[model samples]
Target: MLRLRKSILTVLLAVFTLLGCVAGPSLSAEKTALVVSVPMEGVVGVSLENYLDEAFAYAAEEKAALVVIGLDTPGGLVTSMRGMSQKILSASIPVAVWVGPPGARAASAGAFLVMAAHVAAMAPGTNIGAAHPVTASGQDVPDKELSRKITNDLAAQMRSLAEERGRNAEVAASMVLNSVSLTAREAMEIRVIDTVTPDLPSLLKWADGRKVRVGTVDVVLDLKRYEIRTFEMSPRLRALHFISRPDVAYLMLTLGILAIVFEVLTPGGFVMGTAGAVMALIGAYGLRMLPFNWAGIILLVAGIIVLVLDLVVGGIGVLSLFGLASLVVGSLVLFRAPGGELLNVSVGFMAGITLTLGAFFILAAGAVWRSTRNRVTSGQEGMVQGEGVVVEDLAPGGFVSCHGEVWKAVSEGGERISKGTRVRVVRTDGLLLHVRKVEGENLEEKGAGHK
Candidate 1:
């Protein structure tokens, strides 16, 4: 019994030792990887908003180690830029915004976003800064009070972002208030950015072993050999981006107007009506997304009505001229911004549209004039000089065969005409035709013969 007890104790000790070895505390650090790329080009719009939303949502859900935004933008709407900046500041995970790929820039709103990120980086040959605000059409507004207010607000925002991220607050403020720009090396030297990397691999390599604070808890990053995941915009969001532009909305509106005009000109074509309806709905929706001037819209509508009336009615001297002038004025005021950048319609485009509309009117008016001047080809007026045979009766009024049809006729000379008398048609009056005996024909003989 003692030998069996000893063997059981040894086995239990060995099993416990094996378990301890397998479940021991790991010495290696835990590594995490999260990459969010925002490669925005041209003007910032709704697309950028959607893309940012998607990327942040993914990052928040994944509890990513770090979110990296590959930014390249030429500034955008102030509202959108501010919203993006707030999103970055509120992120639980450390966000790294890298302006990269050589020759890439983060201008205007981009500068604000970069300042907001926990870790801002730039690639060689890249530049950042230039945060001046402007209208949609790239026109600069000269409101001194408004400009001052915007500059102060943006400068404060940049300073806050920079201070939070341990970047250069003064330099960032200068960027907003002075429109200063810096290359990658210059940005890094001035502490506007954390690092200047040649490529993504270098960026990740440099990011390794860095530490960032998350709500009073300092977390050490270990991103070596980490996996990267990218987030893309949804189809619906992409479509919204596509149609949210002023130019796109203008094009849609033009298409709608043309479609409606065509439908009116040629009724009963279901295709034209349907197309007009669809285009108009789309245009209205798109225009609603933009900042529009109601006055301009009213003018445009009135102009269109006048032009349509000119087509329907015979006169065009007053209404047509007024309509053309209204159209020009409405087009000029369509965007309603003092600056040229916010203008949806260019002078060239307006001129072209006006010229085309005038040409169309001229052609249409010519056609109407020609049609009004054309000679009659059918009816009694057409048959006034045509030959006809007396089909029946022998009186001042008789039945005549004209145009292979029988017609009630009367003699203009007040003379009796007989059937098959071979009379000559003189004139017609309200379903009655006047006739005379053929020259040198015996009218009395013909009348007696018929009887």
Candidate 2:
């Protein structure tokens, strides 16, 4: 009986050991906190919108304890910003926007992103605000009533975001209403940001134990036990983001036009045409994310068309001058739309590209003009002015050897020609070559001048 009891105890101990071994890994896994870091830099356009959407989905799937957005942007499209704000507000996990690495800013639409985050932090030397609505060129809206409506709407939106985040709503609204700005420390003092942390590690530590609202429920962040896992934008998204810059898109559009023109001028291989189409599509996609002037686009197209026409019609530089002026003007106004206040086309860059394109257009036109006037060197036209040797004599018809080929011939004046006479080809009628007797030139001299 004692042995039976011992055996049962032994069996129970072994079973318990096996269960503990199996559960240990699972229990440790539960204690590991996951923090997802998403880098948000540059313009908040379609690339950012798509990147954030993917990041949020990934964070939710990983059950992240916190999502940190490392933000550094001048500003971007209002529509894209609104979309990003909606994602932040609707996220199941707490989202923190950190403007860090020093000297970074949350200006313009970036200020709204700061307001949208459950927790907003900025590094030393960083600044925030300047949420005023204006044209892409940073100019005030032209229409008084339209400007007033836009300002009021943006102010209300700013106020709502700050109020929701429990920050200084009045001051936040003033950013949009009066274009106010504040430093990192000033933002903290005025309750615009949660804290000022210099780096991500310090940010995580400062964020630890913070209670923030997630969806309808309030949740506390456990960042102390976190494993910082950075979620990067995919390669394709990174490329799209890179080209999303207004300048890059403008350059791409220019290249696309040039490449297509090249394909049109020399059209056997479709390589240039295909590449131009792709680049044009990409540039269009980038431009679509921003507010652009349709008139500017029309003018751009008109300028290019006129430049091409100059080449086709052999214009004497007048069309070229007008086209160049129109191109520069169009480029100046391309991104200067009502809501594109943050976008800027550098004057130097624009001038450089325009000058280069104008030079290319002029050079190509000159080449085309020269080609039109040059002598023909092949086929029927090549037979004219070519020196030949008459192999058969006749009153009006004979056979002649020209350019190493024999053909039926006739004298230009219908005069009789002796065999072995050196002659010059006047013209070709079908396979027949009209010949004229060469004067003061022997066969050796004529042969030497054949080409």
Q: Which candidate is the best by lDDT?
A: 2
lDDT by residue (190-306, candidate 2, tens digit) is 998899999988998998888999888999777657798999999999988887888888888877876787688778999999998888887888787677888878877778877
* lDDT, candidate 1, 1-451, per-residue tens: 9999999999999999988777664323444466555555544655676688888787778777778888877665566777788888877787888897788889887888888887889999999987755544344546778767767877898899899989889999998777798999999998999999977778889988889876677777778757777676678867776676656666677667767876877798789878878887777777665556777677776776676677677553456777778777776566654322212233575567766775676567557656667786588787777777777764887788878888888876678876676666678787888876665555446667789
Q: Against the unseen true structure, what C-alpha lDDT does each candidate score?
A: 0.73, 0.86
Clashes of 2: 4
> What are the models' TM-scores?
0.71, 0.78
Clashing pairs in 2: 135-340, 135-341, 136-340, 136-341
Q: For candidate 2, what's the RMSD?
A: 6.8
Name the TM-score of candidate 2: 0.78
lDDT value, residue 86 of candidate 2: 92
* Model 1: lowest-lDDT 10 consecutive positions: 337-346
Query: Which candidate achieves the best TM-score against the true structure?
Result: 2
